[model samples]
Target: IAEFNSSRKLIPASNTKLISTGLAIRGLGPSFRFSTRLGYSGYISNGTLHGDLYIIGGGDPTIASGDRMTVKTDSLFAKWTRALRVAGIRKIHGHVIGDGRFFDGPIENDTWSYNDLGTDYGTGGNGLCFNRNIQTFSVSPTTVEGKVNAEVTYPATPWIEFRNCAVTARPGTGDNLYQFNTDLAPVAELRGSLAIDKGQKKESFSNKFGALTCAWEFAKYLEKLGINVTESPADIDPYDNIRYTEAWGKDSTRTGFRYGNMAESPENLTLVYETKSPSLKEIAKVTNSRSDNFYAETLIRMLAKKRTGSANYDSCKVVIIREMDSLGVDMSYGAQIKDGSGLSRHDYIAPEFFCRYLKAMSASPVFKQWLYTVGIAGEGTMAARLQGQSESLKHRIKMKSGSMNGVLCYSGYVMPSPGKPEDDMIIFSIMTNNCPEGGSKVRSFIDGLLMRIAK
Candidate 1:
């Protein structure tokens, strides 16, 4: 008897994916798939894929680098390029065509607050997104000609630009930045240099930087690796292939490719490689565990299309609402969901209502097994905190933890005692909204509460 609702309505954080995912499982079923295909608009001669190489996206958000699906390495086109070159088709006089017509409406969420746009959380929903709209930059400090030299993950070409204002001063505290005046685009434009004091240790920072800007990068990576290309690609009408299909995780067991053989060397030919990402379960686990903003948002939008039978979010929201209604959960109260991962401070949800959803999840058999993995004590969001605590508690805690600036939330199942499993079964959702003490305090409090409950 936690009296969960008394804690207040909090921003859902990544817990929102739970709702989106549950709704997806119900509306789209467990076997659903978001697929991307390679289609030819031109003809082939001598086995050369002689046409505009079209990268047709079925709105699969799990494509390209940093997807962390264990198999979602950013070398699909590169591998395919090598495969094509081996198969003998070269000299493509066309542009790398990436098609993103699967979903409709503007890719970016218009309602997202202005403050979020520049960050990784505010990525665009484009027709073609590679690696969830991010690029990793590895920064290391070195001295160059008495000036400090820093190695950044710059584009392979001289096209993409960075301006760092780092100076070779005594190794100490200095902020290093490649401040671009404008947004990241596919086009290459290196603006300014760094301004960093040289004495500091070679600290590294990795960010999910850029928009859906890596499509060309992927394409370029493939082409430079000698993948045979036909011609310039033309966008296909998504309306032509819009259909309710089973969802597919990157590791579709039906496909026979192993998980880790994705690395490839790219050449100037055209090729197509199928990269396997981790299962949806793994993705969800990591998303919830890390409160990963980028992955959660991607999966949510993709889930919207999967559940609603529509690619647009407006209609997708309707589908989600209807699905939730089927479970006797009403959203009229403090449940306000503006985007997928509830990272938005605007997202609101009643802890009691969330608990109700958690209860319903417990009632489902298909989602039950996967359910525990996403929860606490299952090597997920709460694994570290719940370690050694679950054994003494005996209830087998499974939970999802969420937090933003001033909000913290948890929703999942717990057993009061091990010997009395049936009687011990309990579902709880706790949320702290606008806590004057901030999110860390609320989270620490939750940890304390869990430990107390365990004992």
Candidate 2:
């Protein structure tokens, strides 16, 4: 390694996903898929579903968002509608419930800063998630100074409300808005102001109720199809009151309040329609390509839930560490991973440990799939990056970029340069924390360093 401080524990930022995604690729394999099921808890009598219409969340990230690779429109609702029709059910008499119990515990990470909680990137992961757990708000400049106008949230969540306190600023001031919301709390507030010159700006904010949103959206779709839904979409929070048994694992005292209402299990639910997400390889492609916090967290928690029967922060870390240890990578080498998204300040990892993990994972059968998901120099999150690199140079490098506040990190593989037969490919890890000059400056420096290393 060019830098001698490899053993020093630093915030790997989004680089944390590299480790988690690698674990997923090797452990879960490339063909693993997340499945969401559409079923009914009660009997289907002639034209009516006597009990709850259950939309069970299997932690599928691509339910509504079209696959990033194929660009196929997600006709999820249409598929469900057809299934319902084939089942001879024309009406749902009971509540349309969203069940996302695959993963348990709180929605938002307890370690995440309050500042990051409301932004789209900080949106927490759950068993049932839809629309990337995001809410879109459009703001317009008001004619009166210091007063901005915000439109109602898109996709229209009637259950949740917004308190717009944003103001209009002078031209050239730019948008300086911040949104605040909690995992189960329905209300949100928009604070700060937008520039008057900026007309009709749309901003994306994260929310805690993805399953609710998904069910709500599907209910609306069913209505359009002349299939009557009696009540609005709702979610049954299984994690509401987790039994405090020691065998359940995790500290019961640290468990946060579970949001939403609780309902009886849909264990005996009859199948109606089912949706399968793109393979894990494709998911890793999107998650790493965009450095998606939601997907990363989901994958990690899913893994934890599968192995430990719990998806809380502590359980996830336990499982991840155990997985690495099983692979002969001693996680005790100064690595502390609190959240999968790397948004929490509680996360810490030594460059040496990360590099060691990468090197070990390089020989995996699904390594190529994992490599292809990360952004190339001119694609995905890196679409506007590596400005001066040749196409060949760009293709030779695949990277996952991470930056938040004073932390910036990049970790991935660098193939041997063209025509350099004897040159060895490199798996590199670099992290810069508390950079006084900011993330861009650190990224520029890292870019310069990579060029020299690639040579």
Best candidate, lDDT: 2
lDDT of 1: 0.52
Overall lDDT per candidate, in order of appearance: 0.52, 0.76
Q: What would the C-alpha RMSD of candidate 1 be, to one decimal place? A: 9.6
Looking at model 1, residue 115 earns an lDDT score of 47
User: Model 1, 361: alpha-carbon shift in Å?
Assistant: 1.8
What is candidate 2's CA lDDT for residue 450? 77
Superposing every Cα of model 2 onto the true structure, what RMSD results? Answer: 6.5
Q: Please provide, for model 1 over 89-164, each residue's C-alpha lDDT reduced to its tens digit, 9 standing for 90 to 100.
A: 4645443445565566655555666445534455555445565654445444455423345443532222233345
Each candidate's clash count? 47, 1
Worst 10 residues of 1 by lDDT: 255-264
The residue-by-residue lDDT of candidate 2 on 82-189, one tens digit each, is: 888899889987667777777788887888898788898998868887778887887889864666787656655655656888888889999888889875556788
**Candidate 2 overall lDDT versus native:** 0.76
Task: Give the lDDT of residue 360 in candidate 2.
Answer: 77
